[model samples]
Target: MMTNTQTSSSTERIAAEAPLIERLRAGDDGAFAELVSTHTGRMLVVARRVTGSEADAEDAVQEAFISAFKNIEQFDGRSTLGTWLHRIVVNAALMKRRRKRSRPETSIEQLLPQFDDGFHREKPQSIEVVTNGGGGSIVEREAVMAALDELPDEFREVIVLRDVEGLDSKSAAESLGISDSLVRQRLHRGRQALMKLLERRMKGIES
Candidate 1:
């Protein structure tokens, strides 16, 4: 949830950017370049999380900028310009994923926690804590990213939008063209799968 101060800051930032928005809408090349320079790195991070390829992520960000320029008139002032660009890049990345060679979907049931007759997890001890006691190092971060990359597209996208991109359930649902309930379901299952994956990776390292 956004605090009142955060909300006010965003509003002020948007107001400050009114001139740039006008210039962008007017097809000013300099304004467009400035926009790309200002936001490309962050946008690429969003794209990379969803697409999981540097080349694909870059392509998606480029496509998003083009789309944003062409549709500048559609940008209402309700959100900050950066937020608007973030959504565009996410959509572009998802579209790129759809166009690529599809991978077989992994069974979420395989990743989900299994229960016995008494409704207790069959291997409860197998579930390891996600966080390292020490602040996590780069290797741990890479391992977590690898685990995320292994998730099926549906699960990965939901987690990236909700957890990685920090979108609310409503916002994530709106971005993905799904219902809020579906977003919640996917987020729950995706998180479970991620935890399981991380646990396996940690165990592998210990062995």
Candidate 2:
């Protein structure tokens, strides 16, 4: 979530990019180079988190940059150039994921929170994958990333877009070509599965 200050700053940044937008629309080489220099690092991070492969992430970012340049005339400027490029890189990475993999994914049903009939050794809800309210050692982000990679693709993509990369549910749905409700459902289950995986890993570490 963005604070008022962050929202104001984002608005100012977009406003500042307006002149560069004009230059981009007019096919200025320097403006396009500036856009690349500005956004590539973040784009690579987003791509890598989704695809879970450094090579794939680099390929997706390169493809996205080339596509953005070719499609600059069609860019409407409703989103800042970075936001537009982010969306493009996400789509590009998702495409490569589809094209690069042909393996069966494990079902996540077993990893979901277990049921208790007023009795169980422990409740899964008590576990916090990101931070525990009990002030336990916070789960490392590298651990969380590893857990995310174990999720089935259907669950992983929504989590990456909405939670890890900070795109809103609506934007995540738009990027993944799914409905908002579907995004919510997947994010919900993805988070639960992630927590369960991290909980198991933490127990192993302690043991």
Residue by residue across 55-148, what tens digits does model 2's lDDT show? 9999999999999989988988776777788889999998988798777675789777666775654644445532453344444666678788
Model 1, span 1-207: residue lDDT tens:
221324468768889999999998888989989998999998888898888889999999999998988888999977878888877898999899878847766678898888877695665544335445423678677877888877888888999988877788887887788999999999999999988787777766531
In order of appearance, the predictions have TM-scores of 0.85, 0.82
lDDT of each: 0.82, 0.81
Best by lDDT: 1
Q: Evaluate candidate 1 by giving its C-alpha RMSD to the native, one decimal.
A: 3.5
Deviation (Å) of 150 in candidate 1: 1.7
